[model samples]
Target: MQGHGYAQPLKRPPDTAVLIFLRVLFVVIGFTCIGFASWAMMLRLAIVTRKSLDWGLFVAVLAADVLSIVLLGSEPGDEIHTAGGYFGISLLLGTLVAATAYYLAADIRHFQRLRDAYRAQQPMAMPYGYAGPASPYTATTVPSSPAAPRSPLGPHTPPPMTHTPPPQPPVPAPPQRPAPARIDQVRAELDELSDYLRKHDGHHEGNYEGGR
Candidate 1:
């Protein structure tokens, strides 16, 4: 997960206060995830938002853990069994699935945020297909920035500039980047939208740091 340095960390993580008061509930849910989701979510928060926390994966796991409670709720003769039986297995699988999803989205978000920053700073610094170090993860399949509840204008590559012969360049110069005010407006709009999509979209939680 390279390139997540730009934005300020979130101020408050989701779903901590409620869980704090419901401490007794932890004993039941604790064994369900086997601590996998908590570990994964903790890692995300620790690595991601220095200022705030991120426990999205843990929440997803908690949702799955309720299934265990449903099993315990069953009466002696009820159709629901004393043990979770086959359904109990879903708890581990659910947490693992959540962990997998969190990693994938978080990693992609990290890469794209940095990629956008890099392209903005030095649009032509590296050739498109230079074949740098291989990444186990690739954005090729995504075909675009990570999806979100609400889509925003993208960090598209800068427009191409016209080239003239080396001895005499064209009279007209290439277009300049948008003004600072324009960049700020865009980031502001993006931040606003990203707040809404923080849970669903992986890459867009922070503010833009690089400037012209």
Candidate 2:
């Protein structure tokens, strides 16, 4: 019992004084700051694969961690004497935070580009929420952009092209032509008119002489 008591007093407990913020950072940044790729994997957005993770950013993050350790004061009353050091820390943290946004946007655009290229190759593929393929007149030949807006007709159909019509001169109506009478009908009408005129000729002459 004496030996056990003496050993107990000499035993130093493991240091558990690490801050909660550091613990969270350890979980997020991982052991060697290679968690960016791992983060991509966990989120299922593939901005950086294991093979594609940027070593440049890795070095930068590693350097920032070192600088943060050297520049930051651990004690409650610790202070930085130089304004340059404060500016450096601020700039470093801001860049790191902005990196997250950059990766997010890159992942989304990469997904869009790959999907459009695939659909362009497969022409017949009509995926959900798919608009029609891009047009030839667009700046890009490949349907890389989200396809043109879908019309009521269907997603496969190209959007309607809007343009002004060319002006045209008004067309004048055609002139009406009189109908020709048959030769026999015309001869009969003329003979009838002549006989009627001969019958009324003597009466007409007598009225003219009386008037005179």
Candidate 3:
């Protein structure tokens, strides 16, 4: 007799070390993010100290490659031969490196901006001996004098100065009444006590029950 119902397709078990490798991937990603932040910080330091060895970026890139090995594993798989998994893995890895470089380029630009701002704040020294382009990567020249202002239209007059109006004092707030006057209700009972104290001219009995 034919089967009564269609059999369910068996689910493929996850690859061994799948969870372990994925955990490593997450850890590496976290490490990479921290390393990127550190590199950015170090780049700022390099700009200030005028030194080389951006070890942060170097270490982060190296970690990213090692991380891929965790994903790709050491041995060739059956799928590697049939489905071009090897080529796919290779391409994927190349893209990851390129992406990291592109992302770091922005970080580098930010560091450059910070450096320019710091340089601008400091007094400039004249070219004692001609220092060439700061570095090969630096596309633009750092001017000996501060950058000259450019008018959108050639040679425009400066706009007239405007005074900032004095800040108005905040309006005096009206007195706020207590939300529900339970205290006020009790105040009527205390009115006699207030009158007694006034008559006594601030003299008070030391015979109260509470301890000193």
Candidate 4:
């Protein structure tokens, strides 16, 4: 299974040596809880393999550690119930759980880093035209041009252009009536009176006509 292209082993981190020490410590503690000895080993293997089942086993081991601490402090006999011994065992179990949790978290982070690096190293797929595969088997047909539209009468001829004259402005009509006849009669009367005065002035002096 490890031979698959995508199934390369995770690179060991700088803190792997510390994790190994913690794993050995956990195995020693597992001896105290014989029921959980197998489970503790399974949990370590799951961590190494980066399996989803590891979380369930980790929880089970944590619960087992808690129970072991409780049993140590609450044993039936007075010999096992010493305050100092109970406190020491409690401290050791707590440390084991803490170390296991730290290692699991660090391993998960390292796995994520490896996955990210692998994805970054992979070359992106080229688009359709840049360096695509040749298609020699496919037919290479040239597209045909569209035919010209035909007229119903005879050989196709463009419609004749007819010239349309622009509209002319309307002409103004003459005045409806001529000047009034009374104006012409008044002018002729004024000219006759001036002629009579000029003819009478020569016949009589001005002072003689006024005395008569």
Instruction: Estimate the lDDT of model 3.
Output: 0.52
Query: Residue by residue across 33-109, what tens digits does model 4's lDDT show?
Result: 64334356546656676677666666765665566656665766656557755764665566455545655575556
Candidate 2 shows a clash count of: 0
Per-model TM-score on C-alpha atoms? 0.28, 0.31, 0.23, 0.31
* Native-to-model Cα distance after best TM-score fit, residue 85 in candidate 3, in Å: 3.6
Q: Per-residue CA lDDT of candidate 1, range 1-212, in tens? A: 78868875333323445433333343334335563333444354335533233455445555665564455455455454544644654555555555555554654455456556655665356787787776767635445776644324445655456686678766997898889999999999999888868754544333333321
Q: Which candidate's lDDT is highest?
A: 4
Q: How many backbone clashes does candidate 4 have?
A: 0
RMSD of 3: 39.5
lDDT of 2 by residue, 1-212 (tens): 44545422222322334333433443465324432322322233232323245545555555665565455544234566676557656755654555555544554455455556655655475889987867868746455666655589786777678887999999999997655666668889999999999989988999999999
| lDDT score, candidate 4 | 0.64
**Runs with alpha carbons beyond 4 Å of true place in candidate 4:** 1-79, 127-212
Q: Pairs clashing in candidate 4?
A: none
**CA RMSD for every model?**
50.3, 25.6, 39.5, 12.9
| Model 1 alpha-carbon drift over 4 Å, by segment | 1-38, 49-54, 62-85, 123-212
State each model's CA lDDT, in order: 0.52, 0.53, 0.52, 0.64
